[model samples]
Target: MHGRQQPAGHRFRRSLTAAAAAGALLLTAAPALAGDGGGRGGGAGGGWVDRQLSRMSLEEKVGQLFVTYAYGETADTTDPDDVARNRQWLGVDNGREAVEEYHLGGVVYFAWSDNLREPRQVAGLSNGLQEAALDGDGARVPLLISTDQEHGVVSRLGPPATQFPGNMALGASGRAADARKAARIAGRELRAVGVNQNYAPVADVNVNPANPVIGVRSFSGDPHLAAELTAAQVEGYQSGRAGVAATAKHFPGHGDTDVDSHTDLPVIHHTLEEWREIDAPPFREAVRADVGAIMTAHIQFPELDPTGAPATLSEPIMTGLLREELGYDGVVVTDSLSMAGVRETYPDAEVPVRALRAGVDLLLMPPDLPTAYDAVLDAVTTGELTEERIDRSVRRVLELKHDQGIVARPFADVDEVAERVGPPRHLTAAQRISDRTTTLVKNDDGLLPLADDGGSVLVTGWGASTTARLAERIDARAGSATAHWAGGDPTPEAVDRAVAAAEGHDAVVVTTSGAATAPGQARLVRALLATGKPVVTVAVGRPYDIAHYPQATTHLATYSYGAVALESATRVLFGEVAPRGTLPVMIPTADDPGEPLYPFGHGLGYRR
Candidate 1:
């Protein structure tokens, strides 16, 4: 659920306020130095990263290549005090100590302080953590700060900050430009708060509607559409000219999986040819476009890597195919090693060692950093993992740092950074996409464009009656309309209310939020249809959910519940904007469930 812990109380607030002020002052005075010139000659300080790596012993070098998670004994807090306390407790306070003592290559920020609600708090937290990483003289490689900010469901930065729709919403909109805009906005926002890397632009194509975790996260079920949208997002995020690096992820693909990798390791049964035709296209596009990094998925593909290990720790997947065949020379990072896919399948230390041998340069979110570090060290010491292999990984890691400008300039002013991060233009872009992408699936009987005359109107379903945006649109259309929110499941009380309202109104409108298969939502649709009044059902989730209430007089699928999607749906309902969006995926019915419900490019327009 929630990640990390937070500090609480006035003391925490005061401390954070002070730290932010101090960090702001430091930023103003030191200002980030341009990579053009200054500091350390060709060998001494000039090539400090190289000099330091060369000096590190085999154990130290192995340690330098690891990026570990910081765990604590508490509910993930966002409070500033918890952040301060966790920093000390998790050994994050001495980043310099960890790096200098163990020769750690990088540290990933996972359990952050909860008090980081405002932009200033984020700046302060990053500044303080980075300060700690530089603690002991000049022995540490600059730590890489990362977060999973994949908009919709996987957003770390909350409130006051702009949040965009998930990938499925973008797919429904039928526009690649919107996807690119979303990425650019996300990139600038991330860079503003001192996050250098964003683990996003989910390249997975959700061909299976039953996919639980990645339903809305994926771009589209169609491989070509997914590739086109992914490429657009990559270009957009990198267009800001900020040093932020974007990672196209879960390669070779995680779309067709019905099982969640968090609990169990799911297998990809597609053959190499099937992969090349469907899954590999997006990854190849990303590789050709020169993405900064590629993250391996935790899914096991027996057809590809017969060892039964997930791709994250597979040499055949990471090295032979991605490196030799695809020619990707950028940094190769692993997914979190804590997932059951890695833990349940292999020995603790073996995952990291095998991952490295498989040509992975960075080990992310290991179960135990120190133990994992020692294991790699012991392997190198025993000549199990050659020094040459260590050098290869370290070199790639350092080169990435240099390219990202992290090695050249350690830090920047948080306030100035904030200015570049949340430009109003980005939010506007999100709003634009949300407005354009929402579609109207079907509207039979021409019952839409409710009579302008004021009358009792019943609005049911999740998005139509619950979401503030959709509710506002419906209320705006009818001067004095009464809305009864079904809340995903309509009870007898809800049904009675709907019937009561329908008794006084001309018609009833029921809307569904999320997908059709959402628990109890289908029952609400059946209940509304049972009322026997002229009923209009609108689907505000994916188009596939429309098959449930086929008996309804009117049915419309907007393919999304995002703000923009709601706006477009309202426009179609009010006869303002003609329904132009076509179905990108097939929606299956019970009788012909095996056949595509609404084939690709299915739409209905009101002809005046």
Candidate 2:
């Protein structure tokens, strides 16, 4: 309201000489593959977006930049404690309240948003929110409903949603084609549930095994391989039913940093040259592919910008590096502003404004919406932020909506929703993919394909949950597989008892995930191996577990613990499926050659 209305002859502009060149290089390096150009900007609804853009008030333009969380459900919170928690977590009662008050452009649903079990309920919830957005007091453009449907452990959607094998699993398979298929399934299932944007296909080239956050979330440590898979996943995602946008996130890369941006600001000290080699490939490929959106990382790139500001707030990084150097014309969204990485540095009201100044198209989950909205409004009035800048981002957002056809058909089919998820063929395909991705990284003792002549098998691990799951899977495949000492901390007595029990079985299968971070689990594995009972070890999560217990008779890695993955791994051991998975990452060992102990692209198959 404070800025002059309809500021004429204006286009959003910022200096980005380097970003433009790098983006050009990336585009030239690969063909410019992108949005179908089916939507508004260059698509059929171009005039519609322009018409809406022209009539929008300054406040309405700013509202489009904000996307807040749709916390808990609508069951009416009578308890004061429940009310307080809802307010703190979600910022409003439901999507409708946020939409009407802030004229929000979108809402992101988390697991707790609704106890969504049936896909019908999810679609209905999304439809109701869209209807609310349409009738709300704001700009009334259709809301962009989104969720984090990254496959594997990061999958936010619960059962029946076809949790495909994760990135590392795909990487291990060494099949870009399979990655595309996995993405198509993920995107399609998400769209069926009334979700449009998937903030996934993490392009981060995870270079550090100790990187607590991005491990296994990333495709691989090798930049080129990550880029190839990243491009493939993006291409597959946008092709899904109703067309969901795939975002290549944690820009510049969150791979090398050790800190979790969710809790603290992680720093990346790579020189610009090193960055081009280590971090920039995946994002560049994403840009060249014409991905619909690129989410900025919260990590600091002091070399890119000496300001010490996180990429979300650094104009040099967002505008100069990402926008210009990368030539990313698609929407540039900031990672959740609520994360401690930026929030600890910039408090409530100032974060959104700074992000806008830095050239962000979308401000995601600003911890405090009211305060952030008013601050951006105040910045416009004070001329610290210009109306034209707001306008450009709003148009991009609208163009994406126009492109996705959210404006025309925002609601998903409630009855068809659940039916669309996890088709029989998709489950079968998932099993097939999982089966091929089980890598046999080590077999010094060559104890795999444990004797199947009615021999008893004992599955033992530190935790009872996975131990039980593993044992049941093996039993289902082979006749005799039972837990030696299921699910508990690795007490010496417990390890002794499990070791004792392992001797009675024809073979022992030990599962381990926490070796890199937890020493106790490694001790348990070594103790089991020390029993000299032909123990076969499964590195359930990261493949790094084998380094701690390398003397195991046989070692394998599933790259994930998802049900399909675990089942595939057990099947491989029982000789139901031959292990075809390769090592997507190096597992460093003391006797490592020029390459790590088990170099990348190393996997064993059944004896020919």
Candidate 3:
């Protein structure tokens, strides 16, 4: 999703279109000479843009720069007996009073909302909130509706919207086309519900395996691959044909921290030069791609801002580094202010003002809306934050809306959005990509493609049900298959149960969930391997997990347990898909001998 602005590629395309349109118009009528005294037409256009800005009260303009979470009022007041009470917990509550009273610029919808099952429902809810944002006055601009629909684990639109593998899966697939396809699918879904902005295509490269929040969300550990995927996602989201803008997120980089910013502030110890070389490449590539917005991470880079303030409140990080050094003229939005990283550090009201002073256009989800609004308004009155800064941000925000066609065409038919979102064609595309992307990491002792006649099979792990589904599909193709399932700690007992069940069968399949770092998984895999049965271990997560089961007769790294990835694993196990996917990262060895368990781009072909 384009952060704070439209995608760069989309902007370029629009510019080209505008240029062509102007040229065609010039052909019909003689073009006026440059500097031929400001013509009536030019004056009228300038006056219109200026009048729109000038007519806005100081409050409205400042409001336009503040985006807060919309948890519906009805949600909070819903009776415990109400059927929709559970749905209310998903972050859609009536913040209409805040929007109307404060002239809030926009509202972000969280995936947890109960009202988002279908596109039409989403459309209705969006329209209602947007209408409320206008407050029955034609003066206030329509609200900017946004969501984080990055697919897989981050999807907001459920059911009808097909979910693709997360970025880590895309990285494992080693196909930029797959990333582009996922972006296109995601874009279609977002636009279907009147959601114009997506905080997605996480640009963070998961260089640190211990990164808690950005693990599977990141595309790859390789900066170059992450850049390529980021560009692809940006292109796909703003293909403009889909009418949605994608934002490349968690800027400067969120993939190296062990801390989750949602819970605590993370510190980046890198120097400016190191960051420029390693951490900043994907963001720069996104900026070069002209991403509409950049979402600032809550990380504190003491080297850049020694005060230990999060990037959201650091002028050097936001303006000096992002705007001046990187030359990103697009909108710069802060990540949720509700996150502990910022909330715990700064005073309630001071956070938003500090962010505005740091050149942040959008203050996202401040804990208290009225407090933030009053604080920013007071800052402007006190000359702490100039009205000029407010104007700058408002203009960019307006321009984005205009560019995304949100201003000109405020509402779209709910049916149309429904039709476009998760269409059969897009789902088919996701399935095809998943089928081709599932990787087979190891097949020693030729244990894969188990005989159809193989009697009973044992399936156990964190995501065993998903893995079992794939195994069932493969088993169907092979022969009549019986499978037993067990969840949690693949322990000696767990493996023993599976082994006992598979005693009369030809092979046993053990699936491990979570990352490879979980201790119980390793013990279970070793126990299963010791059973002397043909062990096929499928890692429905990161390739690093496979280090735990090096002795397994066969190993597959599906990268994720998403529905699509599971289906892809089925195809690979059945020798249907080519299993062309490779390891996108170096899987470390258990012995800590320093040699990688599996090298990048390592995959085994059936024939080989």
Q: Which is the leading candidate under TM-score? A: 2
Ranking by lDDT: 2, 3, 1
> Which digits, one per residue and each the tens of the lDDT, describe model 1 over residues 163-182?
78677777766688788878
lDDT scores in order = 0.66, 0.77, 0.70
Q: Write the per-residue lDDT of candidate 2 for residues 410-496, one digit (tens) a residue.
A: 888877875689888888888887787898877766677765677788988855677788888888766688876534347677777
- In terms of lDDT, the poorest run of 10 residues in model 3 is 1-10
TM-score of 3: 0.86
User: TM-scores for all candidates?
Assistant: 0.82, 0.90, 0.86
Candidate 1 residue-pair clash tally: 22
Sort the candidates on TM-score, descending order.
2, 3, 1
Indicate whether candidate 1 or candidate 3 has the larger lDDT.
3
Better of 2 and 3 by lDDT: 2
